[model samples]
Target: MSILMHVCTLVIKILVLPLQVAELLGLYQLYKRVFPVFIYNISFSYNSKMNDKKRELFRELLRFSPRAGPLRLLEVGCGSGANFQHYPSGCRITCTDPNPHFKEYLQKNMDKSDHLVYEKFVVAPGEDLRAVEDNSVDVVVCTLVLCSVSNAPKVIQEAKRVLRPGGAFFFLEHVVDEPSTWTYFFQHVFQPFMYYLGDGCEITRATWKHIEAAGFSDLKLLHFQAPLVFLIRPHISGYAVK
Candidate 1:
């Protein structure tokens, strides 16, 4: 088993050698352009497979009524607007993503979901959301994002900053499993390959810890195992109130 795992890892690395070379040669623009297309294709199947679980979770977290008027939402790392269907009707959503290439796909999703109001898409990392005003949004949503960020804590802080007092930060992310688990062992083994193929996603991050330390007034986080690839099955989902 050990030898087989090593061989599989080697095979995966060999397949991604071109990506490694691109990075080494500073072909960042090419990487940025290609990654969104890669994720957009993969997300269709992934979303379909995780549809029930994700739909239920989104419904629960986004259930709250705003104090007044339509709910204002800011989603960090809003790749291809995957959560559009789950949002309540008349939601005013501002989408942000580091990759500009996703805007085209995002617009298509927005056009399909006419029930929700579409705000402009901003090209910004979650760690620095300077374009969004402080305390301006009713809810901040992040899904499958923390793992790829260079600094999870900074992203959470920015999320909290943009949310109105009493607004909520809703998050759903895959995290590292327990140390003794076989999944955890493999997560570490294939992490480098995943980091490249996934456009900086790190499977072994303990993302829940960053949220816990963000000083939310109230937090309700839970852990579960998603029916996904073994390396990314362990997951966390819930909300934190500012």
Candidate 2:
């Protein structure tokens, strides 16, 4: 049994080396070209467990706000425009992502959705969204984003700054696992590789804590586990009013 265990561990270690090499070569962007499709497939299964919770939360918030004109949505790190299908009809959307490779995917997704008015795709990080005007957006949507940003707080601040009064900030993010657990320990242990392979994602970010500290009114949140059994399973989803 001991010899078999050792062999299994060795095989796992060998498998990780190629991934590490890819990271060192900065091929993550290229990797992401196809990775987004894989993620969407997994997400279709995984997110169904949550009953389309993020989309539900977003729609519920939108109902409360006046829809005098086409509701303006600013999505930070809107990778491949996955959330575009979830939005209501006749809405204006500005999708931002740092990866230029995503432009083709974003356009493809946008073409599928007749309801969304494609504003533009900006190549910018979440921490700085100067291209978006202050007090202009009706809602700011961020999902699976905060973990990978260079600065989480600045992203929150930028989100706040862009939202019009009574505008909503909806986020769904995988947070750090509880302390003293094996999962938490391993998250930290493999954090460097996680950052490299995940495009700067920190598996152990206490992002929900930062959201609470951002000073939003009516800050409602839901803490839940994803269907997957991984260090990034502990997640928070909800909205805060600006």
Candidate 3:
């Protein structure tokens, strides 16, 4: 197990080295902007697979959106439309993002898929989502997105406003691990560069605390981890029943 762990660590460092290098050079924004397109292109190649762990992280929330309520859903930061395939039956899935590229690119790519439910694609930021109507959506979903938003707290508040009573909010995010020494150290050391380059992501944030402040209760975390090697905080993904 120790040998395998070392091997995994080595592989991760090697793979992430380019990003680290780019981060050093202040080209992280360039990297972040293009990474989505690269992912879009690569996702089509069956050999370039979704890592099982990432799939598991997304699976729980994606699978839940279908059953949350009978109304509709609004997904904030629908990157590359990656979560589009998981919409529940008989539900309306409306997605929004500030990236204009994502607006057309995601639509063109995902439009061909035969869906089990109704879906709509829109271009808007979270704060302005009030145009969608109050208490109309059955659920608000955020996937790997809270980390990159300009105003995550405001977005969460808007999500609350748009959701109907007894509805649910689901999110899957990478967050800070308070318990791990290495995690805290790296986050402090690298967060400035990461923020500038990775679209305002905060490695030291209390994402769960923010969620609670967003007025969500009855929270249930399906999965979470805080081991060394820079925590991924997958437990950030869970349901907040309204």
Candidate 4:
């Protein structure tokens, strides 16, 4: 089994050699351009597989009174707007992502969801949400994002900063498995490769810790195993009230 794993990892590395070369040559713009296309092509299949559980979670977390008019929602790392369908009707969504290439895909999804009110998409990382005003949004959301950020704590703090009093910050992220587990072994083994291939996603990050220490007034987090690859099976999902 050990030998097989090593062989598999080698084959994966070889397959991504071109990307490594591109990065070495400072062709980061190439990566930025390609990654969104790659994600756009695969997002439909990925979302279809994860829809049942994610839909339920979004429904629960996004519940708000219509009496408040449209809810103001800001989603960081809003890749291709995968969560747009799950949002409640009449949400004024402000989408942010570092990759500008995703805007085209995001607009396509937005067009499909006529119920949602589209606010402009901003090009920004989760760590720095300077374009968004403090305490301006009713909800902040990030799904499958924390693992790739440069600083998870900074992202969580930014989420808290943009949310109004009593607003919720919703997150659904994959986390590292416990030590001594086979999955943990695999996660570490493939992490370096995944970091490059996933554009900085680190499978072994304990993202829940950052969220816990973000000083939210109330937090409700739960852990579960998602039906994903072995390296990313362990997942966390919930909301923190600011």
TM-scores for every candidate against the unseen true structure: 0.91, 0.83, 0.70, 0.90
Better of 2 and 4 by TM-score: 4
Arranged by lDDT, best first:
1, 4, 2, 3
Task: Show pairs that collide, candidate 1.
Answer: none
C-alpha lDDT (0 to 100) for residue 115 of candidate 4: 97
Write the residue-wise lDDT of candidate 2 on 5-91 in tens digits. 356546655667877787678875577677666555555665566556756776765653455787888999988777777788888
* Clash-forming residue pairs, model 3: 223-235, 224-235
Better of 2 and 4 by lDDT: 4
lDDT of 4 by residue, 161-189 (tens): 99988889999999999876889768867
Using TM-score, rank the candidates from best to worst.
1, 4, 2, 3
Alpha carbon lDDT of residue 209, candidate 3?
A: 81
The TM-score measured for candidate 2 stands at: 0.83
- Which digits, one per residue and each the tens of the lDDT, describe model 1 over residues 191-226? 878898788999999999999999999998989998
Question: What are the per-residue Cα lDDT tens digits for candidate 3 across 69-177?
Answer: 4447788887676666555445567888876666655776466545534367677887779568888777788876788777889888888888878767887777776
List residue ranges in candidate 4 displaced over 4 A: 1-21, 62-67
lDDT of candidate 2 at residue 218, scale 0 to 100: 74
For candidate 4, the per-residue lDDT at 97 reads 98
* Local distance difference test values of all predictions, in order: 0.88, 0.80, 0.66, 0.87
Show model 1 residue runs off by greater than 4 Å: 1-19, 61-63
Give me the displacement of residue 24 in model 4, in angstroms.
Answer: 3.7
